[model samples]
Target chain A: MKAAVIGIGLIGGSMALALKEKGLIEKAIGVDNNVTHTTKALELGLVDDINSLEQAVQESDLVILAVPVHAISGLLPRVLDLVDRQVVMDVGSTKAAMLEVIASHPKRSRFVASHPMWGTEYSGPEAAVKDAFAGRATVICNREESDKDAVTLVEDLYTTLGMHLVYMDAAAHDVHVAYVSHISHITSFALANTVLEKEREEDAIFELASAGFASTVRLAKSNPETWASIFMENRENVLDVLNEHISQLRKFKACLEKENIEYLAELMANANKIKRILK
Target chain B: MKAAVIGIGLIGGSMALALKEKGLIEKAIGVDNNVTHTTKALELGLVDDINSLEQAVQESDLVILAVPVHAISGLLPRVLDLVDRQVVMDVGSTKAAMLEVIASHPKRSRFVASHPMWGTEYSGPEAAVKDAFAGRATVICNREESDKDAVTLVEDLYTTLGMHLVYMDAAAHDVHVAYVSHISHITSFALANTVLEKEREEDAIFELASAGFASTVRLAKSNPETWASIFMENRENVLDVLNEHISQLRKFKACLEKENIEYLAELMANANKIKRILK
Candidate 1:
């Protein structure tokens, strides 16, 4: 099968590489507004060729949207308009608002919504890496809304990439990811800023930062354009999670103020239960 | 050389392993309040033998107080009472309070306050690994206060472990680590708590959590007994940095609430400066 990947940055570029590496695609086409990204995707062998969105969608058996969440909502309906037999899939971070926008499209069944639960804090074609999706979970949202053949084709492609698939409603997927993924970026950005603000001695930070600080703030290096769009697209859920996170930080601050070691320890012990899920 | 590791937990156990692996010590003696930790330290080959704190200190040419900061402050005086020609060093997270408590002791010259800027969230001897300190910074705090020979011995030892040595004052070490290390743990614990409190679907979290979430929340699983003591011991510096972190988070929340995407993007872009230091 021939595949076209739109917005060929990290996710799209990596997806293009995965499809080609796994022999799931005879040819992978790249489509990006950034000419440099399109050219780099080709140069890096992430895609077979660069093409206009319309041209790529017209020629490929599969068209994947790997754009920002904001762009996905706008482009999903237009892509659905352009497809008849070609299976369309999106790998955006949030699903609810985009799914809602495309819900009434006549060709909605031809489109599948998915989020490959894999990414690094880096982006762009240069950041694309081979074997990026294996051993990761891929969420298929509102799978029932898609045509059976479309869902099956996408699921099979992800499985070929060695990804485990989970199914969830669009709304539920957004809420869960807001807690697990979106807020992580926010706090990490804040953490970087906190150090930048308070520890003006940049030399000390470089001299003193442990592996823990590096991993903890790693997400702060994520693409701002992409994450800002994500935060805006899933505004309510992001806001809700951000409030809870801030409240949690305040609890730690309050406990420290009162020297209430017991309460603080209890909080951390509760958090430590995450080991069961994470490990 | 003979070495005694007082705590026989993560830091100490790992230290013992590094000493053995690098041929820095012929024998490592373990001393922990917990009997199980001592047995496990030996069973895991983290130490050659287990002994009482005084016995370990007296027998070894070098003594490492690798306990929590609270324990280190108390044990340092007693360990000093037992030492004359032997060198003593500590690997605790904080230094100001501990250093102040022993500032007037004659053996203060024999004690070197060093904090290896390396650790994992897990604890105890079983969590120890060989060659744990390579490529990490080992900060020797208040170096001028340590005896010249003792300082040279540690500087050479860490250098042999493939570590880069940095020297800073105790007060500055405490303040800087609050921004770089302690605050990372606080935010990670808070991030985990936020998810556990709001996202009730444990299965969804297990399925949807990406590598980013795993790294961001990694420190949340740190040993509570160890962390609570560190927080209390460095209470002032921690509170100072935590307030700054909250202020930064509030900035993100405000921009998000107002839908001022520009400011939020700028905040993240500024945070991206961490790459210069961390990389």
Candidate 2:
């Protein structure tokens, strides 16, 4: 199978490499708006060739949208217009907005909505890595909307890359990701801001930052444009989770202010329950 | 040098292994109020033997108070009373309260207030691992209060373990950790609670949890008792930072509520500045 990966950045470049390496695709074509990304993707051998979006879609058997949520929303319908029977898929963070935009499209059955639950803080073609999706869960949203062949092909592709698939509605995917992924990015971004603001007055604080602080704040280094697009795309759900997170933080503040040691201990003990799920 | 490590838990047990592996200590003495911990510490070879506090302090040439901050506050003066010329140091999260407790003791010069900025979410003797402190920063606080030899011994010990040392004032160390360490744990705990609370209603939310969620919430698995003690001991500093963190989070919330994508992107861009410090 031949595949065209749009955007040709981290996720796109990585998918192109993985598909070709695993023999899932005979040739991988890159379609990106960024000239530098296209050049780098080819130099890095992530793709066999670079093509215009319409040309790539017309020539390839598969079209994978791997751009920020907002860009995916704008590009999916246009790509669908240019597709024949090609299996189209997206590897975006939020699903609802993109899926909603294409819900009434004639070639909707050719597009599969997926979010492989994997990424690093880095971005762009330079950040693409092999085996990026291995051992991670990938969510396939509204599978019934996609053609059986298209869905199966996308599922098989993810499975080939060592990703376990979870099926859900696009709306549900957005909500769950709001709780699990979007809010985490917000917390980390806010934490980085908190520490940075503090560090301006007290320069020595960052020296004491250990693995704990680094792990919790590393997401702060993620691309701002990508995340802001995600937050806006999944606005209501992100807001809901952010509000809950703020309330949760307020409880900790209350515990400290009132010196409620027992309650504070109880809160932390309750949090320890995450061990059951995380491990 | 003979070394006694009290509290035989994560920090103490790991310290014992690193010191022994580095040849900084010929024999490691274990001292803990928890009989199970002492037994496990000895079984794991984290120490040569389990001994009473008096025996451990009296027999060893160096003493490490690796218990939680609450226990250290209570044990420091008692440990000092038992010591003659042995260099005593602590590996607790907070330093101000611990140091203040022993500020007027006749044997004050024999004690060093130090916090090794390294730990895992797991705890106890069994969780201890070798080379845990290597390549991390270790802060020695209020070094001028300690005897020159005592300070030198602690510095040499951390250096031998392949850790770089940062000298800090005890009060400053407490405040700094509030920003770098304590606030991260609080954010993680609260995030865990937020998700757990949401999961109670939405069962499938956790299925979509990814590495970003795991990294940000991992510290929620930390021991409740240990963290509670640290929070209460450094309540004022933690509260201050927590307040700042909450306000910072509010900025993200406001951006989402107001649909201010530009400001949202700006906030995350500012957060990316952490890359400069963290890397």
The best candidate by DockQ is: 1
- Please list, in the order the candidates appear, how each scores on TM-score for chain B only: 0.98, 0.97
Each prediction's Cα lDDT score? 0.92, 0.91
Clashes of 2: 0
The sequence of per-residue lDDT tens digits that candidate 1 reaches over residues B1-279 is 999989988889989988988899999999998989988888888899999888888899999999988988889999998998999999999999999999999789999999989899989889898879899898999898989999999999899999999999989989999988999999999999999998788999999899999999999999998999999999999999999899999999899899999998999999999889887
In the range A61-151, model 2's lDDT, one tens digit per residue, is 9999998889988898899999888999999998887887888999999999999999999999999998898998899999999999999
Best-matching candidate per lDDT: 1
As for candidate 1, its clashing pairs are none
Tens-digit per-residue lDDT, A1-279, candidate 1: 999899899999999888888889989989999989988888899898888888999999999999988999889888888887899999999998998898789999999999999999998999999889999999999888999999999999999999999999988888999998999999999999999987878899998899999999999999999999999988999999999999999999999999999999999999999998999
TM-score of each predicted structure versus truth: 0.98, 0.97
